[model samples]
Structure formats: C-alpha cells, structure tokens
Target: MQLVALVPAHDEQDRIVATLAGLYRQTRRPDRVVVLADNCTDATAEIAERCGAEVFVPVANRDKKAGALNQALEPLLTELADDALVLVQDADTVLAPDFVRTAAVALDDPEVGAVGGVFYGEQGGGPLGLLQRMEYQRYAHEIHRRGNEAVVLTGTGTLFRASVLREVRAARRAGLLGGGTGCYSLASLTEDDEITKAVKTLGHRTVSPDGCRLVTEVMTSVPALWHQRMRWQRGALENLRDYGRTPVTAYYFRQQFLLGLGTLALACFVLFAVLNLSVNGWQGAAPFWTAITLIFVVERAVTVRGAGPRAVLLAALLVPELLYDMFRQAVYVKSLIDLALRRQEHWYAT
Candidate 1:
C-alpha cells in the first residue's frame, strides 16, 4: 500500500516533534507526510516544515480539528489513488516503530476500510497520569475483546483506505454526512467515532490489529480531565442523535444505539439507589454500596495490571477512583439531559 500520513495540529509546537520523529522511525515509513498546521500561532508550522513535512496552513478554519482536517483532505481527493492509504494521527501521540507495519497487514483483507490501534497514556504523569493510564488500559482491553470489528476508530492512531475517504468526501459534498469537512463531522464532538460509523455505514469494516499501539498524553489535573470527559460523553450522545436521524443501522450504529440505551438504563438504576439512600438512610444501603465499590476497585486492578505494579498499586486508591467514576457518571447524565434539551456544548480546547 502507498501510505500517506497526516497530523492535524493546532498549537502543537511543544509536542509535534515527538510524533513526527516517531513516524520517521516507522519500519514502513509513509510515502508522504503532511502536517496540517491549522491556524497555529506557535512554531508548529515552521517546525513541521523543518522536520521535512509538507505543511498546509489553512486560509481559515472554524470547527477546530475536524475543520482543519477537512481543509487538508479536500485537496487530497484529487491526489490519492485507489491503492493509497492515509493514516490520520493525533499531534499529541507517538507510535511504536512497527505500528504502521502491523496495521497495514490487516488492510490486505480488502473488506477492512480502516484500522484503529491500541493506545496507552503517556508515562510518569504523576497521579492523574497514572489514573488515565489505567483508564486507557481498560479501553484497550475492551476494544481487543471485540477483535477486528471496531465500533470506533480512535484518532490517536487510525489508518484509512484512500478510496473510502474519497467516497466520504463525495458524500459530504452532497450533504449526506455531517462531519465538519468531509469524513469528520463538525457538529459531533467525537469525530473519530463519527468517521468510524461513516465508514461502516458504507459497508466496510473497521479493524483493530494487534501489536500496533499509540501512546498519548493524558490530562494531568481534575478540572482538565472533567472537561475532557464531559466533551467526549456529550459528543457520543450527539452522534447517537445524528445517527438516529439518518435512520441507518447497517453497521455499528444500531449497536451504539443499543449501548446508549443500556447506559441510560444503568443511570436510572443509579438514580433509584441514590434516592433510596437519601430517604431510608445510609445504614440500609451501606452493604450494597460497599460491594459495588469493591467490584469497581477489583475490576480496575485487573485491567490496570498491564501498566505494571505501580499502576496496580494506584488502583488501591479505591475511594478516589470511586469518586472520580461517580463524577464521570454525573457527566454522562448531564450529557443526556443536554441532548434532550437541545443545548449547545463546546470543547475546551487549549
């Protein structure tokens, strides 16, 4: 496969170097590397050019990352061949040397339209980083369980077939897909998830290949993590709503819809428990709550073992993790309410 790599960036001067350097070291290096310097004020464009990447600073961009990507990819609709592959990697992530090689092997199946690799949180980030590391490990675990059929192709390290992208491009031009530019939605918060559904809705499969992983930085503070998760959860709800509007269920959209319903049911159950605890007193609910807490801690511990002993040890912060999970749960609930009320939400991009 003739490979072309794109890194959509905004003010990524401090970190883009590592990502480019990692790509340069890939066992099967991309034939072309384009760094879409989306309205950057920093040295991001200069650094990408200095690093030997073709830099495209958009004339204008409004939808953040997705818009920047569309601006960059619009031109590629004419540049790519049917046999070409495009890897859309995040500015903040670095990949293993063989990551591209491993993922390319899966594309040989012809039925696969895209490939999403496993991702780990950047190491040595103190408390918040370790917590995020564990969280990512759990994400990887669940994604691996589902094999090659993926519900979402993570932006951290997603490889796409060029033909499907062109099709998406054409669809967007015709106003069929709702992404900001072509394949990625400006209206949705989680463009990766939207792209995954778009590809699947076109009758192609998304693959998850083994031994190909990306490492990315995670939020290092409570406030940052909260905002990030809120944006992510809200984006998910919006995608469900948009997909519902399309009335399409050929691929994973139906599965995601069902999963959303399941989450709503679980949230309702939590609400019932909270109401009972408030009215009947904690004495009666103490045993039930303790068991649930222990289950959460144990499950976290088992999943976090991939990060080594230190992370497994951090899983002992059961109380803090429990509180954090509760916070995330509340975010999920608020997201549902926001979607129902037709409220607008924005990503707190830095």
Candidate 2:
C-alpha cells in the first residue's frame, strides 16, 4: 500500500533537515513526504525541499501544529487515493530505519485504525535534560509493555489510515468533536487528544508497536520543560471537558480517572505535610516527609535505570522534577477552568 508522511513545522530550520533525513532512511520509504511550513520566517521550506519533500506554506494564521496539519491534509487527500496511509511526525523527532515498516505491518490488521510507536529522548543537555530523557525512556517501556492495549495521548510519531482521517474530518465538520468548534485547530493545545478520542469513538482500534521507535530531543532547561508539560497537561484537561458526559468509555475514562487521582494524591500529600508542620512543628513531620521523599527518589531511580547510568545520575540531580510535574498539573486544572469559562487561549511557542 502507498503511504505519505506529513510533517508540520514552524521555524524548524535547524532540526527539519535531520528529521527529513531520518524519514528518507525509513526501511519502507513513504510514497511522498509533505512538509507544512507554518508561519516560518526561517528556511524550513527550503530545507524540506532540498531533502526531497513537497512543501506547503499557509498564509492564513498558523494557529499551531494542528492548523498546519489540517491545511496540508486537503491537498494531500486530493492528490492521493482515499485508501492510502498518512503518517504524522514532528520536525524535532528522528525515526528508526524500520519505524515506518513496523507501523505499516501493524496497520495491515484491518481492525487497527491508527498506530503510535515508542519514542526516546536524546540526552546530553544537562542534568534536567537527563531527567527528561529518563522520563521518555520509562514512557516507552510502559507503552511497549502495554502493547496494543495502550492508551495513546500524544501525536508526535503516529500513523493513521486515510479512512480514519476522513472519518475524523467528517466528525469535525458535523460539529461532533471539540464542542462544535468546526474542526479543531492546532491552535487549541489539545487537538491531538481530541483527535485520538474521536478516532476511538468511531469503533476503530489504536495500537502502539513495540518495535517501532523514534528519538526525540527534550527541553534542556527547567523553564522550558515547565512550559512543555504545562501545555500538555492543560490540553488534556481541555479535551476531557470537550467530551462532556459521554458515557465513560472504558479506555478514555480510565485514562482521565488516573490523571485525576494522581493529581488528588499529590495535593493531599502537600496539604497533610503543611498541616502537620503547622500543628506540631517541623520536628514531628520531618521523619515522615524525609521517608516520602526517599520513596520518590527510589521510584525515580528505578524508572531511570531503563535509560542507563547517565540518566540515573540526572534523575538524582533533578529530584524536584516530580514537584515540577505537579505544578504542571495545577496549571492544567486552571487551564481547564479557563476553557470552561470560555476564556481565550493565546498561542505560544514550544
């Protein structure tokens, strides 16, 4: 079957060439590669073209990745047959040589509508960078272990059958997705989550192949990491709201419930620690807090072990990453409230 790779990029000149090169190296090369150069002041289009990709630059507001993707979709669908496969990837990610081949083989199963693969973070920026690397490694391992039953929430390196895309597009047009927004834009930070849910709602299966992998570069600084996670958490909450009262489907409901429980657990821990300190002084709660912290450190170490020694060391140095993640969840809660209240969501860089 013929396949097309769609890459949405914005000011990614430095990284686009490497990503395209990786695509070229795929064991099962895509029939065509389309790069959506959204609002780029740089030479992203030039680089993509040089690397043998068909490039499109949208003049309209490049709201975000989703917008660029939708803009590219119409042209691609018009040019290719309806039965073709379309793979979406990020400009900063590099796929393994066999990644596409593996995804294609998995999609060969008629029941599977979409497939996501393992993604690893490249290391060596700093201590925080190492923590990010370890986090990605743990994520890859968990998804691999879960196999096709995994619930995928991100859209970094995923493949979709053209039929699924058409269904999603139709749902968007009928105002069944994203609270009647008429085809969600990439501008809405959580468009990926929305799309994934939409596809699942149509009774098609989404799978993650253990053998397919992609290497990604993580944010090196604490502030950058904070922004990245905040966007993700906030988007997730927003999408959950958009689904409003749909009888909790097992897969989707379980994912949301776990996130909510995790948030509640963290909040309870902080509140208990504060109240104990206020009533009995630091001495009384000191031991308990230390023990809890040690437990967290050990858990982090175990997770980082999958990435090797350097990652473990980085996890040790960045022990506060969990707190940072908690902060992101708090931001997500706030963002969800804002979205519910109809507050505007301004676009920002990643």
Q: Pick the candidate with the highest lDDT.
A: 1
Q: What is the per-residue lDDT of model 2 for residues 211-244, given as tens digits with 9 covering 90 to 100?
A: 6788887887766766676677666666666576
Candidate 1: clashing pairs of residues: 179-184, 179-185, 179-186, 180-185, 180-186
Candidate 2 collision pairs: 66-186, 67-186
Model 1 has an lDDT value of 0.82
| C-alpha TM-scores of all predictions | 0.87, 0.86
Candidate 1 residue lDDT tens string, 220-267: 887887788878888876776677645334444565456567666767
Model 1 — which ten-residue stretch has the worst lDDT?
A: 245-254
- Best model number under TM-score: 1
Q: Evaluate all candidate structures by whole-model CA lDDT and list the values in order.
A: 0.82, 0.76
Deviation of model 1 at 119, angstroms: 1.2
Candidate 1 global TM-score: 0.87
* Range of the 10 consecutive residues with the lowest summed lDDT in candidate 2: 178-187
Off by over 4 Å in 1: 245-297
